[model samples]
Target: MKAKVFKYKSDGNTVVASYMELEPYAKNVYLSLSRKNEDGNEDDDCFHVVCRIENVYFSSGQYSRRFLKGEDCREEAATYCRNWIADTLQSAERGAFVNLISVRVFEALGLDTTSLVQAREEYKRIQEQKRREQKEKEAEERRVQEEQHQWLLNEQKRKFLDGERITGEMFLEITGRDGFDIHIRTKGTFNRHVRGIDRNGTVSFRKIKGCRTPDFTGCHKAVSAYLAFITEKEGK
Candidate 1:
């Protein structure tokens, strides 16, 4: 037995269906449906259905090819395809045509659509899980950045307190700056840029509010007191 191929076209000429032959004596048929794109060109998407004559009769084979013998095989296959297009894909709505045909093919094969439904649910579940994972990863990164920033702040404060041992010359030389003013005003309070409390471009200093002695060394005590105040306030 030689295989045969048949093609069907819609009345609007936008869609085409093909009934392709399988192996000779296999008693199986392959149906392919395709539609043209907006520019009237055939798109790459194609939907397919495959079943054997015997299986069709055992299933929903009301118009099954089981009755067709010998020379009527090709004609029977074409007739079945026509009825399928008329009853199953009635509207010729190109967008949903593939989905419609899939339902019909499954019905014709007497197969339940539960697997398809479960597959879709599983896909959604996987996508949602991925979204949660991504969110958690972003949150973890933010926490790590915050921790690093806090650590840097604490380190800067610690060095500022250690500035008590630094001489004024050493401070100026190490900072690599010129024209820095360190002066004591009326009540012996010294106003000076605090060492190690550096902002990228802004000047930072500690005001020795209660100092009655004009000494730059008292600046470290003021910075330490400020640090303690900040820590206590933050905890509260």
Candidate 2:
């Protein structure tokens, strides 16, 4: 559909010109067409078609300016202006101009906005689904971590109860507790006695008081296993 053309005065009524104005299709949006001339001459290059929405302006540019300069220019400008409005509306439907165009504008123009509304709803649905999936993924990760932690604790308890041979490092870790004193005799020698005094002042030895062994490494491993068993029992 073409916009209605009308004549108006320009530059303090010294120049006479005709311009086309379309019906307001959206709130605060206006479309108009005028001759691209300084003195409103008929020999201008082409018509100037523009659409203004709020503070922003969209021009038809060189394409609309190519229309022939004659009485037919008004109809051609109106046709191009209508196409420009349709393009703007299509952009809004795709969410490009979502914040600029409103439902009231579609109603004012008597255009159905079902596709635009559906597009927005679909976008929201996709985002909500993604959030739900992310939450589920995080919950599954936490569940696996907790299961691994429990498995490690169970394995440690089993080894302690079985009296398995532990390293000298393990012995130090167990005796490093607060208020515990580790006593090492015959340092770096074959005959070594490794023991601990607990916070209650009780001595820790492997199956005997002041446990001793000819092999220093053997003594340390035996003491470590004994301390680990005692700590596990205390914890239980």
Candidate 3:
């Protein structure tokens, strides 16, 4: 594809350029050239950029010297003609715009095409940067979700251990209810502790859940001391 740059008289301020491509197998692009001044009148010696800016034009069989208007460029637009415009590759060679208008005036237009390598390189760099940013965003989201899920699992584990110990404690308390009337019995007739194996290597712990129902509101340290006493004195 090839691109050209010029100012169109229809819209003077905007820099107008188009890309064009001529398919080798099909009809070649048609064009006609003319010269004119700023007053919209035909002249032989007008500004080259303004005078001969018409890139493509058509005729019945052979193109006469008649300079077609801008809108008449699409004499017979072809599929291959779409890629033959300026802006196809984002830029053209220096002075290419000036020569492009003259190129289409030929009958069998066999012209070399150009691609803007500089624009392609810049576009690739921008795509890589966007990919990096997207990866970082997804990683942060996954990390936050994992942390919250782990916290919930640990909380559930703590609750489960607490409830098991409290259940055992309540059972022991109820069994000793009827023996409250006995007096002056033995040295260690009733031991109210149980031992359980854990990753901390038989560490002492207290019942947590169901503590209020059994009226067993021992502080953490006091309950730990009770577990130590039971394991030592009761030989468990």
Candidate 4:
């Protein structure tokens, strides 16, 4: 089958990769080029490469089947491609990015990168677009995390106030009932702490857990209950 080459141009270097599908196995092959830029040029161009492959058929005979490795054919071809790209870059003279790519590499794969210059530009555009989308997504995530952090600080202070100004202990005392304080626990469920207080306050002190932003009221209930129990036990 005739192999197709996809080229992506950068500031200092360009990627010339190969893609092909061979039959009767119909296996897909990808050969990617990784070249380091020596010129240190600022890359303003980026893009993605998508190409159509021409089918390759093998004639059935003793000679044709003799060299075939069946399912391993694609892998073998890919390995050869990778080796050639690396070896060529290493041996190539240091100069321009275009000069770094050897003609022999393309000849070895029966493809040409020079002819796909226009296609390379399009591919670079696609790559740049994808990069922008990724950056936006990451920025949004960071913004959300910052907002969440601020909300946590505000909630912590809010739980401390109730006009008369309740401490973690006082909130539970007034709201607590039956000589028991409200207890709250968390296992990452319910965003905040579990909806309400557990007035029975039977949970072990070690079992009371909290996360970044525990429910404001829930925390008050839990802390008050523990403090109240402590006060009563002390005969205060």
lDDT of each: 0.41, 0.46, 0.36, 0.41
- Give each model a TM-score: 0.30, 0.33, 0.30, 0.29
- The candidate that achieves the highest TM-score relative to the unseen native structure: 2
Please provide, for model 3 over 128-218, each residue's C-alpha lDDT reduced to its tens digit, 9 standing for 90 to 100. 7889999999999999998876665455335433543332333234223313222212111223333322212232344568653222223
Query: Which runs of model 4 end up more than 4 angstroms from their true locations?
Result: 1-68, 71-115, 163-204, 207-236
Model 1 TM-score, all chains together = 0.30
Q: Count the backbone clashes (under 3 Å) in each candidate.
A: 0, 0, 12, 7
Give one digit per residue, the lDDT tens place, for model 4 in 107-187: 445665553333345556777899999999999999999888666545543553322233333333333432453434422
Q: TM-score of model 3 relative to the true fold?
A: 0.30
Ranking by lDDT: 2, 1, 4, 3
Candidate 2 lDDT, 1-236, residue by residue in tens: 24322222443222222345543433333344444566655455343344443323343333233344346655655565556546756765665533213343443456687765665666677778999999999999999998886665555445544664333333344434323444444223312233432222233434555654334543444455555656775799
The better-scoring model by lDDT among 1 and 4 is: 1
Candidate 2: list runs displaced more than 4 Å: 1-110, 164-236
Shift in Å, residue 92, candidate 4: 25
Please give, for residues 167-208, the per-residue lDDT of candidate 1 as tens digits.
Answer: 333333322222233334411332244333321211234556
Please name the candidate that would achieve the greatest lDDT relative to the true structure.
2
Measured over all alpha carbons after superposition, the RMSD of each candidate to the real structure, in angstroms, is 17.8, 18.0, 22.1, 17.4
